[model samples]
Target: MYKIISEETDKSGMKVLNIDKSDLIELMEDYKDRKYFLSSITGVDMKDHIDVIYHLHNFDKNDYICVKVSTTDEKVPSITKLWKAAIVDEREQYDLMGITFEGHDNLRRILLPDDWVGHPLRKDYDLNKVQYVSVDRDGNEHVSFDDKEGW
Candidate 1:
């Protein structure tokens, strides 16, 4: 349902494609037949939107491809079904960028607690309003925020 918006080669000589999120699954399915390895998934919190980037490598061809999907709605379809390797990456992205991956199995915060309020990586995240939490060796949890500094 989507088309490639652009293509380019990075400094590492890897092929990169900026595509619509709607077309990611179909494109990935096509690459699956060629046996592309899922290298990594990264999320960028752009001011206007969030970008999810997927890196794939075809070892046989000595080639790498990166697919980028930018979404303003903060949501995208999960490709975890096609590449199980994306599980942790997807969760990390969701936790940090506040982007949701629909249909992802076990999508949850990977680096933050369940009670964490905001995505720390977001450009608009308020650091001064952050809560500080500490855990003792005895497994006691202490959560507090700086009232004077608002941090």
Candidate 2:
């Protein structure tokens, strides 16, 4: 059995189960054969590594278990192979935190542009500004959108 943590929530007490990244599917498949369904999948950026959180609940046990996958290589295990709901959340995590879900059938940018560089949700992100677009030296005029908005 995986170690469980009792995380305090505003709504009351919520039990949290912590599982290793490599064994995520193993944990899922254990209860999966008993029909435990997935509830949610999301991520938190921790600078050097990204933490992908997966929440699954068992109707029979009435308990919630979570799995965390962390990696600095930008490659993540494909939980999409087990849980279809992970498709969107994994894409969003990749787009925002730059965590690549390896082995995913179709992993792509979900919210930001395909060419967008850098993860927006990382702890090291600069909040003072989104990002400065480079000035086009090819005779194109550059104007700050804020400056023209007054017109």
Candidate 3:
């Protein structure tokens, strides 16, 4: 159900498939019988759209495939049902890249605090606008809101 907009192999000999967002789950499910393991899920902010890449590997065949889906919308389908290992990766993407996983069971911040203002990993995030917690030598906890620029 997915169209391959582009397909190429990198220098490392990995097959990269650029597919539509709607066909991600279906394409993955089709290869489920072949025991393709979910290696990782990564998100990139491309200004106009966010790119979500799913890296899969077949240990038995020593083959690898990277599926890429570009979407302007923040929400995407969660493939946690197909691969249970995606729970953490998807949640981290939601937290950092501000992408929402519609069917995710626990789509909360895996790294940042719940009260954090913005997604730090996004290109638009302003470090100077952030307020973080600090501690004093007297063992006093304090919230510091400074004009600190970039990390």
List TM-score per model, in order: 0.85, 0.70, 0.85
Candidate 3 overall Cα lDDT vs. reference?
0.84
Model 1 lDDT per residue over 88-140, tens place: 98998899889899999799988886557889899999988968666667664
Computed on alpha carbons, the lDDT of every model, listed in order, comes to 0.86, 0.68, 0.84
Task: Provide the lowest-lDDT 10-residue window in model 2.
Answer: 142-151
Q: Give the TM-score ranking, best first.
A: 1, 3, 2
| TM-score for candidate 2, residues paired by index | 0.70
Q: Judged by lDDT against the true structure, how good is candidate 2?
A: 0.68
Deviating ranges (above 4 Å) for candidate 3: 134-151
Residue 33 C-alpha lDDT in model 1: 80
Q: For candidate 3, lDDT tens digit of each residue in 1-151?
A: 6578899998888889998899888888977778899999999999889999999989999888999998899778999999988999998898899999889989988776665678888998997785765555765444445534221
Error of 1 at 149 (Å): 17
User: Which residue pairs in candidate 1 have backbone atoms (N, alpha carbon, C) closer than 3 angstroms, thus clashing?
Assistant: none
lDDT of 2 by residue, 17-117 (tens): 55556666676777678777788777787666767777778888897766666666767677777778878888887888777777888888876655555
In candidate 2, clashing pairs total 0
